[model samples]
Target: MEIKVIAFDADDTLWVNEPYFQNTEKKFCSLLEEFLPQHALSRELLKIEIENLPLYGYGIKGYILSMIEAALKVTDNNLTNEAIEKIIGYGKELLNEPIELLDNVEEVLQALQGPYRIVVATKGDLLDQERKLKKSGLSRYFHHIEIMSEKGEDDYLKLIKHLDILPNEFMMIGNSLKSDVIPVLNIGGHAIHVPYHTTWAHEQVEAKLDHENFRHVEHLKEVLGLMPV
Candidate 1:
């Protein structure tokens, strides 16, 4: 079947997202090491953040706050006004960093724009995604941009229904195996997995090699070669 709608995953799929988090985590981890053992502190922070996912969702701002709260809780230290100020300063730095779009993302999207219906179906902070989209200068190619809090079976199902597109006629292209591939395949849609070099810890999932509807590619630009139009 000919593909009609081409959906994409934002964040690390098209740009540098997790790296920024990694950088922030490195800074946080260094400070944290002063109060707690590095390994213990890292594990505890992960536990706290994961536990708070329902409340915090995902983003730099929420993550920074969680780190601060975790430090206070784990050390039993009353967070000093000075330390709070440092955290706030780091948060501002994180927010101000420039968005980095991956190589060939703009070129590939622009090439495929006229022939197919392009859409960005990303899962992340609304403000962050919006900022990246606006700054990337590739937003014009997409007819639809969806900034979702989460990517699951229901989310994909709802998008399919809203777009009024058949499962067979749609393609979900993304770097995630769990969020992007499985959900699309579960809904009877075609999905292409472009394995990114670096994936967020939360977004990582075991790769399924035997899936019939799922295809893998080395790069985002490779999608154009697979399609007729």
Candidate 2:
């Protein structure tokens, strides 16, 4: 009840993200379906993504690289120049996507803004996250923005230090349990999981949680009732 900072994860939490990526994945699978079945290519792309996470980090650029790599594998290095161009086009489309804020995002932020030192603590390419935040028009609500390379306990600890808030005095709201909830909970911060309709395979986690500081909400609107007005 004494939380001083409320940090939100940017991607799916604030705006539509995974669904766009899912659609792009479908386009990708279709593009290479002749080289391999849709299901197989999808799995292969995920495998490459997870494998490439360290080198490329996270975001559209990494996803594009994985797609190109998968295409090469599926077609045995015989992928057409046109196909490569199309894949690059997919990445460009994702990068140029309009920010569509999730339901109640601005409303809830408006409600909580005065009471909380709101911030964005999200993981992605800095340029891309900054671009999305700029497009969302919600940047003014946040006191600070932390675009992380990764979200782990240490990262949250560093953020708490930067913000000069105790772990117990910080709360994180996000769509990914793996990236958002677990790390905050592990660091003794509060977290609420606001599940999105679609999730990337990399962000999925099993639901057997045992942390007292963690809560799950059916929607962003429900989060309003958890604190004072």
Q: Per-residue lDDT for 131 in model 1?
A: 83
TM-score per candidate, chains pooled: 0.94, 0.98
- Over the stretch 126-194, how does candidate 1's per-residue lDDT look in tens digits? 897788888888889898988887788898888878788888778899888988888888888889998
How much is the lDDT of residue 56 in candidate 1? 74
Index of the highest-lDDT prediction: 2
Best by TM-score: 2
lDDT for each residue of candidate 2 in 1-229, tens digit (9 for 90 to 100):
7899999998889999988898999999988887788899999999999999999999999999999999998899999999999999999999998999999999999999998899999988989999999989999999999999899999999999999989999999999999999989998999999999889988888878878899899899899999776
- Native-to-model Cα distance after best TM-score fit, residue 60 in candidate 2, in Å: 0.2
Give the lDDT of residue 184 in candidate 1. 87
lDDT of 1 at 73: 79
